[model samples]
Target: MIKALIIDDEPLARDIIKSYLKDNIDLKVLAECSNGFEGVKAINDLKPDLVFLDIQMPKINGFEMLEMIDEPPHIIFSTAFDNFALKAFEANAADYLLKPYSKERFLEALEKATQKINSNAPIATQKIIKDHQESVEILDRIVVRFGNKIHIIGLETIRYIQAQDDYVDIYTHEGKYLKQITMKYLEAHLPTDKFVRTHRSFIVNIEFIDKIEVYDKESYVLHLKEGQKISVSRSGYSRLKEVLSF
Candidate 1:
């Protein structure tokens, strides 16, 4: 049987989804969540195979919530917004069901999700997050969950980003925090004028730069406040020079 989770802020919407799933004997509704924070906890605890997710929720939206999870379930997005449909599909969502959709449409989406789940296909969550980042408006803050606590890191507070396999480490005045995201995604969304990729694995906030020093003929290093240093590749150094005009 396919274990399912419903994550929608509206009580009516959650009930509607539950009603639609009643006919599908192969799927079982395991939990219902009103907001993204609750959804995250439910997903982590329940480990459901499929999720009916709503985009706009309190505290953090659907996309931000997904970023917190290392492995997200097969997601069928139900949202009133149409602008995110193309990006959602590109991110490999199991399906996208616009709000006020008919039962027939919901069945169709369910069927699609069921087929993928039965075949044991991996959900393209990372790709989906990256695609969503590129399509959406510039984010002013990043929402992350550390244990049971949710933290919102303002963009201005970020000092640098370092790549860590499938994740990235966000550094600030307070400390470093891990986020399951990619360099390409960060580069696409972050403001170009303020942050620059100074190496294959490092993107630094130019606002915190104290100086740029020569490491050798082909290499350079960035000096920041508190005596912190970051290596700068030849290409990265060139890009930094072009952006900083120095």
Candidate 2:
């Protein structure tokens, strides 16, 4: 079901929109806002998929409200004015329903909005997941024991790793530190294509790699293409060749 938020200045207008939404089996009116300020706040907090937005209001207008939110929802402009039709479409609005439009017209606009929502759902879900994962501060930094005192190391600074028995030694542009985690478990969170395990004990950052150092074997030694010398196993080398189309 598509969660919807309604924003209109008039109470009767709100009632009319609510009645129309009642017939839409897929729509649920999650919240109601009388003005654009409240609408912006509600949208940011609730993150609804569909918004029934009125163009003209007391404070901020519909267009301005869309500008304020970090991630705007599928907007269906509910307005009395038809002059803004060209501008609304230019702004990539999902759909628009003119005031006093019949149920048939509203259904048409609603269906159009639904199709837009469905088409973009996958991309939007990915963004949400990425944002959630990146924003999580749980493992953003790690504490390293430097002689007697502990040092804080940023996770983003890590460039590579080599497994040493039960502990993994981390290599970064800054320096190296030992962390207690298996290579298999750590690979799950990192981008696999970007970071590859060349040996049973090592995982290197591909971006920092300088060049592939070919020795006795023809296998592509991940020279991090940068300056860092990281080895690539025969199996890992084959996978990288296919991935890079080499």
Among these predictions, the greatest TM-score belongs to 1
lDDT minimum window of 10 residues, candidate 2: 123-132
lDDT of 1 by residue, 131-163 (tens): 777777666788877668777898899999999
lDDT tens digits by residue: candidate 2, 191-225: 66666677676777666656666754755556654
Which stretches of candidate 2 lie above 4 Å from their native place? 82-85, 90-94, 121-246
Q: Model 1, residue 198: displacement in angstroms?
A: 1.9
Clashes of 2: 9
The list of candidate 1 runs beyond 4 A from truth reads 22-26, 90-93, 119-127, 134-139
Question: What CA RMSD would you report for each candidate?
Answer: 2.8, 14.4
TM-scores for candidates 1 onward, in order: 0.83, 0.47
Residue 183 in candidate 2, Cα distance off native in Å: 49
